[model samples]
Target: MTRFLARRTAMLVATMLVASFAIYGALYVSPGSPLSALTGNRPLPPEAKAQLEARYHLNEPFLVRYWHWLVSALHGDLGESIPLHENVSTLIGQRVGVTAGLVLLTSVIIVIAGVGLGILGALGKGLVDNGVLLASTVSAALPSFAAAVVLQFVVAVKLGWLPALGTGHGFADSLRHLLLPALALAATSVALVTRVTRAAVREETGREHVQTAVSRGLPWPSVVRRHVLRNAAIPITTVVGITIASLIALSAVVETAFGLNGLGAYLVQAAQNKDVAVVQGISLVLVLAFVLTNMLVDIAYAVLDPRLTLGGRAA
Candidate 1:
């Protein structure tokens, strides 16, 4: 277990280094430098531009810029936002909690309801199965933005059950306003988890162990509990981890549609404004989220089956 954890830690560090460096390269490769944009359209004189360049280290080599950004990043400083004229880290921090909450709540809903539906669908190959399959297919086919819009119209506008604008308050109020957006982000994820779980569980039930349990008259439910569901959870856990990672960026449309001021929405805004610092900051956050989610999935493998290793070392 210790060896496994060490390997995973090494892999995680390598992934972060690669992701951050790539983001640094992209930011530099873009045309019309951030410094130029930060300056006004009045066309500052050569001397003035030079002063600005020297002050901001715009004249530094690409390597210098990369190293500077990386060092600052290590200290939790993501630099300043050109458009907002504020610390990018500060701006991102303001929205991180909201986004994290939305992501977590959405994940919970997807696992519990979606996986439950999937298990039910898999247990019987009749109308319930067909219905669940159809629903999953439709949800999967729909683009995330379209799903948000449709939900906005039917649930938010038509029924008026959910608020179109987000509310900041106690947990109850926040959840009430977050319902629509969370549902939109979760719809496709739920479908994927449900479909995958159902198939995995059904397949597990047909295995030799499950058949033997049935032959021993261990009661159908007991057989499912011991031999089928237990094995099925492994795959379902994997899918859920992926779902959580995807959810980090998937909430953008829902955030915009519902006016929930979250990281996804902030990222879109930064992109539109061409605020590279803010955009990269948000991107780094998402990458971190992806990495953490994967680590959690790895840990869960050990939780669900002790036979699994922590870092994929010898069990």
Candidate 2:
């Protein structure tokens, strides 16, 4: 178990390195210089341009600039934001929690609604299952942002059931505002969870252990509860873990639609304004969060299923 975990950890490190390199390289090569963005179409004097370039190390060789940025970023220095003139760290810190809260709420919805539906659909396996499968398919097809618009219009504007936007305030009022947006954000994720859980449950139901338990005169509910659901959840658990990691930079469009001030919103604003320092800091933090979340998810596998750890079985 320890060896397997160690090996997976090594692989994860390699993956992160490759991903970071790609992210950094792409950021550097992306068109439109921050200088141009800062100064706009008006041409700056040579001396002014030189000073600006020197301040941000734009005068350095590309590799040198990248390496310097990497090192400085490691020490919590993301250079100066040409536009905002504020510390990148502070800007990102101010916004990250909002996104974290949204993700948390979305995860709860996905787990509860998704898994609950999976269990129900799996137990019935006919009209109920088919209907859920169709709905899940639709949810999966729609992007979060588009879904947010649809939900906002139908639920908030048309139905007048919930508030249309914003976060923070009276718990009930804020929650009402959050409901549609969170559902929109979570819809695809819930679809994923439902599909995974349903497939797992379906497969587990046909396993020899399940048949044997059934043949022993156990109630179907008892058999499913005791034997199938836990084993079935293993694969779903993996995807759910991955989904959480994937949320760090996701939900920007949702934020825009619903007027939520989140990390995703800040990222879009930073990129649009060419706030280089803020962009770099936010990107680095997002990548690190994903890497750390993935690591935690991997560690959680062994905890969830004994078969994958401590010599129970090779997976």
Candidate 3:
């Protein structure tokens, strides 16, 4: 376990370093000059241009600038947003809660609806199973942006069930405001989870032990609980973790569509305005979240099946 964790931790660090470097270098490699963003493509006096470049260490070697940024980031300093002129860390801190809340709400909906529907489909026959398949297929085909528009128009704009814009004040209001966005964001993920769960559960049900349990007259529910679902958990968990990790990136589209003031929305705006610091900071944070979530999923594998070792070998 120790060795496995150490290896995973090392990989996580290396992945983050690589991701951060890529994010930082992206602007340099892009079509326009980094200075063009600062100057809005307008030529500045030599002294002014030199000062701006110096301020951002654009005059330094890429490696030196990256090292400085990386070192400061390690100490929780993510630099200042070039356009917004605010500290990147502070800006992210301010908006992270909204995105977190949206993702949390979406995750809840995904787990409950996805897993329940999957179980039903796996255990049911004929129409029930077909219905689940239909639903999953339809959802899988629906993109987030399309879902967002439909939900906004039908649920928020037309039906008046929820507010269409902004992260509302307070817990109850926030949930109300976030519901549509969450649903939209979760639609495809829920479909993915449902399909994966159904497949995994069905596969588990066909295993020798499960068949033996069924032949021995164990209760269907008992067999499902103790054998099928338990055995199916690892794959279900992997899908769920991937879905959850992806929410950070996917939230940008949903948040923009819904006009919510979250990190995703902020990231879009920063990208539009060419705020390199904010873009790099938020991208790194998203990558970190993805890595950490996958790590947790790996840990969950060990918990879900004790016979499996942390190194992914059978004990």
Please name the candidate that would achieve the greatest lDDT relative to the true structure: 3
- Give the 10-residue window scoring lowest on summed lDDT in candidate 2: 306-315
- For each candidate in turn, the TM-score is 0.94, 0.88, 0.95
Question: Which residue pairs collide, candidate 1?
Answer: 4-311
Clashes (N, CA, C under 3 Å) per candidate? 1, 0, 0
Kindly report which residue stretches of model 2 are placed more than 4 angstroms away from their true locations once superposed. 1-16, 170-174, 310-315
User: What local lDDT score does residue 218 receive in model 2, on the 0 to 100 scale?
Assistant: 100
Residue 315, candidate 1: C-alpha displacement in angstroms: 12
lDDT of each: 0.85, 0.80, 0.90
Q: What is the per-residue lDDT of model 1 for residues 159-182, given as tens digits with 9 covering 90 to 100?
A: 998777875699998988887788
Clashes of 3: 0
Candidate 3 local lDDT, 253-287, one digit each (tens)? 99999999999988889888878888899999999
Name the better of 2 and 3 by TM-score. Answer: 3
